[model samples]
Target: MRSSTLRRHLGLKHEFQYRQWCKANDFTSMIPKDVKIRKNAAEAAAASQTIIDDHAVPLPRKERVIPYSDELFQQAAIEWLIETDQPISALEHPRFREMIGIAACATNGVKIPNCKATRQSIIALFKKNLYDLWTQFAVSNFCCYMVLSAY
Candidate 1:
């Protein structure tokens, strides 16, 4: 197959990496100069079976290794959670609002600029009506449950 056709078929990226890899290896000279590209009776019979044997070698199949990255996905869920609520809902109280704030801070390690400023921001952000954002964040733990289940 034409290289361009195969590249397009595979959605092959023309990135620096593949170019570097191609430059590092000489496919044409992989066999001795005397050897023909196509298999010939003389070449096949006299040649070490190494080349053909290498072709028969199968790559190790990648085992499914689902990772549990609670920290990584916690932020990812924010987008989905935002979809479920309006910014108005983002301000209103949901379930377990206080617990929600502490958990959100703990899970994401939410920190204030400094402890004094953090206290001030928490006081401001967790006012009665707006505290619901924390509950929404705690419910985010359910997404963590999802990553756990895959393993």
Candidate 2:
């Protein structure tokens, strides 16, 4: 079960027992002495860092300029779907679309390619990869043949 669900169950079903257990167990005392020492050290370091940061001059915020290209985005989305073994229909999912939109930094969200376009893009990418592999194999074989001929 999810942590939230488990917490809710414990709170609703065993509130009394949980309170008794909390009262009985000194949680901090249960921790090893070394761990408690390290925890205190970390807290002290964080406090010093906070003080230093407060005294430091603030830097000017620069505006980030992200170039948006629909074709590139679609290609990337297609590749991501293929790499993750997700169905083409995943593009149409509301949550997925929202995430994509947020990532692309678009207020209304970017338009995702339809299933047909996505399928075509996947096929094209596969053919391109196959061609690239074939070319590499051919080049390697040619190099080997040339070396053999020279010898």
Candidate 3:
């Protein structure tokens, strides 16, 4: 049977729904708890990319995170942006860009704002021109208020 025809018949919400049906009928041993959260396929392709294995460490107070001064983080982000430019969205992912900026700023004796830029365009601008980006978004947006705003 064609996939579209099957889709028309079952009217499952998505691919995972069919997987759930399979699991319920004993086609598989277990159903994933968070099937909605798809794994990043690009990360799998980049075998050299370091997977952050540290999930157990508790998030410390704002002052607790060791500031990024070593330049290692910046280098990695630059490598990705410069070399492949594959998924421009990495520059867009708030989590990824913040990590890069936090590490870079901390190394420069500047505090990594508890908040960081959210818009992808602004984030890209930040990479190209820091002062201009700061002027437009207002540096205050990336300051400690971001923690509360983030929530």
Candidate 4:
């Protein structure tokens, strides 16, 4: 049967719902549980203190998370705007310019190695540092800010 017809018959609006319906029909509706959580619980109950496994191979060490500072990020943002020729005033909307500024600064080479900024991270950083960005960049004596205020 066509997907639309099946959807209409089954009243499924999404693919996950269809998969759930298939699981129900196939008698495998129960979702799989994590093996590690169960093992951890069993070990906790069995021993007074847990011991580390020396025989187990150690996982690779992750890179240290560097804390963000406003000064460094703002400098990067200004430099990025200058280098990329994406001056804040040229953008149509104030909010979009601010968001781009945040992305440019927050994903600086020192902070995010290779600077592959995700939209979610940019948005989060922008929201977290909204006041700083506004006071430092938006309401400042910079030419761009003066032009933005005029609009």
lDDT of each: 0.56, 0.76, 0.59, 0.63
> Lowest lDDT 10-mer window, candidate 3?
29-38
- Measured with C-alpha atoms, the lDDT of residue 120 in candidate 1 is 84
Badly placed stretches (over 4 Å) of model 1 are 1-46, 51-63, 79-151
Per-residue lDDT tens digits for candidate 4, residues 1-151, read 4754654544434546755776778743222222355677788888966556776788796666556688975787678779989867645567866766676565433344344566777887888798787777754668786788899
Candidate with maximal lDDT: 2
Q: What's the lDDT of the predicted structure labeled candidate 3? A: 0.59
- Writing each residue's lDDT as its tens digit, candidate 2 over 11-63 gives 67776676577578844322234346779999999877645656788779655
lDDT of each residue in 1-151, candidate 1, tens digit only: 4754645533344444544554688432222221343457567677754557656778896555334477755564566468766453543456535645565555334433778887987788669546687677777888888889989
Query: Candidate 2, 120: how far from true, in Å?
Result: 0.1
Q: Over all chains combined, what TM-score does candidate 4 have?
A: 0.23
Evaluation by lDDT, superior candidate among 1 and 2 = 2
| Model 4 / residue 140 / CA error / Å | 47
TM-score of 2: 0.33
Q: Any idea what lDDT model 2 has?
A: 0.76
Taking all chains together, each candidate's TM-score versus the true structure is 0.18, 0.33, 0.18, 0.23
The number of clashing residue pairs in each candidate reads 0, 0, 1, 0
Q: Once superposed on the true structure, which residue ranges of model 4 sit more than 4 Å away at CA?
A: 1-64, 90-151
